[model samples]
Target chain A: MKEEKNIHTNSEVLVKVEGLSKKFCKDLKTSLWYGVKDLTANVFGNKNVRQLRDKEFWAVKDINFELRRGECLGLIGHNGAGKSTLLKILNGLINPDEGKVTIRGRVGALIELGAGFNPILSGRENIYNNGAVLGFSKKEIDEKVEAIIDFSEIREFIDMPVQNYSSGMKVRLGFAVAAQMEPDVLIIDEVLAVGDIGFAMKSFNAISQILKTSAVIFVSHSMPFISRICDNIILMDKGKMLLKTNDVGFGVQSYFDNQKLLGALNFGEENIILNNVKIHSENPRLEGIIEYGKKSIFEINIDSLNDYPKVKVSILVYNMAQINVALFESRYISIKSIKGQKFIFDFGDSFLSISNYFITVRFDDLDNKKALVVSNYVNYRSFQVTGAERLVFAPLYLKEKI
Target chain B: MPLETRIYQKENHLKLGHLFKASFKDMLSSRFLAKQLAVRDIKAQYRQSFFGILWAFITPMFTALVWVFLSRSGTVTLTETGAPYPVFAFTGTLIWSIITESINAPTASTKSAKGIMSKINFPKEALVLSGVYKLLFNTCIKTLLLLFFVFFYGVGFHVSQLFFPLAILMAILFGTTIGLFLTPIGMLYNDVGKIISVGLSFLMYVTPVVYVIPKEGLMKTIMELNPLTPLILTSRDLILGNPPAFLNYFLILFAVSALLFSVALVFYRISIPILVERSNA
Candidate 1:
């Protein structure tokens, strides 16, 4: 294997894409009709596939990139941003309309785990079936069967019918086989987001090891994973490349900055309406920003038509990934005959990393079991913590004197 | 040791000269995967069933028995078929069933593997080869029962029986040729599959299955004109040790089907990616 790697030098370009594009129809009926027409054109050797017909739009447009051996390219974009379409074309599952994609050596895609597995068959039997589909000969699979079983950590259930196995077990087995495939060009989608944390970490480590040899194309929404593995990054949106740079951090930062903010959402009983949410800071320059070690006060205004005996208010803050980071709850407060009421909480010098965060306010019963009214100020009242960007493994930067 | 490079472009896909070479290479490479898939399907098909593989034999036998009962009860009158009527009906039904299975194989196999195709990039030819593998497995079982029926009816074995395998291969090839041509379209529109079964039941009547060819009439002319007639008659004649009346037609059909089968292979190669994109929807 080492000698083989030396043969295909690290600088050898394994994948090249030039002006690649594909058009897809939105309507099913029209798509089928176009399929018939495209097939006819293909049969007749017609070269008119580049033009988009009625009801068709470009799914991937004029995308170009090159990847060489031992280089990993990260593809970051929001959903429906043509990242998946680009990966499909690179994997050779579909054809491009305008340009060409030249890929050398064997290519493997981790698009979906356990894709070819038959549930009725035993896990052991499916390993062989899946291996064969991955282009492994019988003897080759025979040699790696034990290693795959060990890697999956389901040796005891190897002979058990896969239908009876848990979903996590199937994913483990699938990842095990894929990890062992030493393809020259590896296309990794978001398949790492499966199984439990332990298995996911194991697969991630295995993939990072494989990255040393193969020219990899990785697509994921997790910025940390992308920054950790990708030597370079390409940010895409609306079927076009937004940024192509060696600075993984800048690319990821741009991706976060490009996320569209959500509007204010206040939904519940019509009688209790959320009026406004405002933040007050001591420094006018940091009015909307929350610094790592600064005091900020958040005020919530509500108009209640009917008086409530007792209500509890809870404020939850979530990061850009929608992960809950902070929660502040107020004890029971009686509100009677108050048309306009206010609740205020002071956030004092909390150490939060520089990123965008949203707040969700919920008014629940005194017991905190039932919600009376809820208001989500996702992007409408979102706040950003400003600081010099630094590379850290954890989501939050917690500082303590040492 | 240079790596094997594959280039994908719309125009490159239309290169008819390279399509056959690539399809054949993929077919050869996918043979092992095809066998594995076929074995998995065959095992899973009968794994949990009560009767297991007995159903494969029971199905054709039951159909053959129904026709035999109809013939014996005077519900349908039939002309003399040289050998015993039960043997004649059973063999005819067996051959007809093989043909139908082959016709349905490509689409059926591709549909079953739709889950994998959209997710993984593999040699698409594997699905077609796997379908053929499954068809051959089922055919083997049916042929065993067919031989038993032929001998039990006392249509004593003859040297001409040596040609049975070749005759059967020709039948499968003919059926598969038609099937391969329809698979690309069939994967896109299920109407092709539904229409095929309906058309096949009607077509069986005109192909001399479960009945002898008419002695002299318009029915005979239709039977003679049917492409399947030569395949069925030649296979039955070879197995039953009768001088094949349609040997020349069978040979000609074989040559034509072989040529068409190659064309269909290339067409499938060209049309599959487009069909796959639609089916993924």
Candidate 2:
């Protein structure tokens, strides 16, 4: 694993954004009027006032970052948190209202796949069109057309119009073109979530191949992806940076903590509300960091409205995608639990992937065949599992003897 | 290759010359993309239509036929137009269509690419250049029709007729310049496009497209004052082997169009991103 340190101090900076901010109007009419006014003001030599006007709010504010070569910066945030806006500004699709961004290379952006494709044009023709839109010349496209078709694996349908191609095929072709461009700076936003798992893997391989040389900025809500690819992560909330860290696990944890603090509503009935949830290492003195190969305990406290018998508490550990990694049932603990109790689930070893996991505690009444309460069902409490290995995708680690 | 680029907020001072040079370089480098876009538009235009490219000829021919009917039926009396009625009307409306097309091309091109522009980052100049390409394609088709009418009217070719292409180029320059200036405004408001459409149709009447200008009347004064009148008149004179009239006015307009186009390019480079940003918002 590469040492997690500030690479900016030693490497050549490829992208530098300073004091960047953008404001957007809520209403279309007002936006248009403001555009005209700004244009007129600019033409007449009026200094651009950086303050917000009526009905305008900052979409991104006071962002500063420097990305060096061979380092990928992951931008994570909730929807409408200005991630896309920042990407747009970096791609030169829009200008910031208050700062400057200097990019020192050709930027190949897969912001939206197949953005300029003409539905009436054949796939072969659209390769030229879409490639040109990405700054490739006609002769260059002519030289690389075969490789693009081969990479997309859609050579059989290259002569057919794009309108006839299925959605997955379109994504394949789009990503193939973008991946082959060999840009010095790559800005990709949630495009890897497209296509089937096979194509996604192929795209990931392509990205990693590019990461060997280019400086990349990736925006995705997938924690596993960010943990896998990004050396530095910026956790953003409401258009402001909350934390920037070199530790991927810590960054993902900070993002989840911020999300929890933002009051993401819990869905379970208040009959058994979660009183407290805490994670600690096996050693009582050391807390917070969960290291791999060490026993850890998850303590969940629930407050019950009334005393109830035959209550079973189940602790479920889920990966970032909410897929269950492991489930621990109270039956294994040999505890006769009732309402209003603290349940401690202990694992022998933390063999889970080096990623974020969410714990969901479910309180069920066995006699009545009903769920009495669930703890943080809507927004589960997430914890990070850090390990020595940097590349781990699946939830569980297993060893097999040949 | 590492191509350095910068993004910044609106500042009080801008190096206009540097900005213009950079924008021109960007446009020139993206010429292949512009050509590809033009090819895409031209191919898609007639793909689903029953009439296809024939509509291009049918529109002006149909317009000329209607005006000829009105003249023959004595519904609208026209002044002496030395050439045969069909030939004169055809040539007039053909030139008029070319000008209107040139004026409409920029807005239409930019508007059609609005979806992609908001999502992808590319040189917006490519759209303008592609619009010019489409205009050229249409002009080629119209020029062929004009030659057919010229011979049909017994107006044989003369050495002066060699300058007809120059006149057509001037008309395009004039219309495209005005269109470029209107593009940003048009992208912001749908009403601009509608207004331009309505205004161009009405403007043709005062430009002497199908009728001679009145000798002495308020209409003549307005016709004489129209900047387009000199353009259409000089072009028509050249095509008919007559000494080009209003050459000075046309030359002045030509120079103004060039200057306006440069300004328009700068305006487009600055405003288009803002417009796209707002639209995305």
Best by TM-score: 1
User: Per-prediction TM-score of chain B?
Assistant: 0.97, 0.93
Model 1, A43: alpha-carbon shift in Å?
1.0
Give model 1 RMSD, 1 decimal.
5.2
lDDT of 2 by residue, A1-402 (tens): 123322224377889999888899999899999988877766665565678899999999889999987889999988888999999898888878888888876788878887789888899988988998888887888888998999899999999989999999999999888877676688989998778999999999988988877789999877678878998888888888878888776787777777755343355554666666676667644444567755667676666675556665566776654466866555422223245567676655566666777666666655457655533443456767775754445434222111
User: Which of the CAPRI classes, incorrect, acceptable, medium or high, describes model 1?
Assistant: medium
- Residue A375 accuracy (lDDT) in model 1: 30
Among all candidates shown, the one with the greatest lDDT: 1
Q: What is the C-alpha local distance difference test score of each model?
A: 0.81, 0.78
lDDT per residue (tens digit) for residues A183-242 in model 1: 899999998867999998999999988888899999987665787789888999888888
Consecutive 10-residue window with the lowest summed lDDT within model 1 chain B: B10-19
How accurate locally is residue A7 in candidate 1, as Cα lDDT from 0 to 100? 67
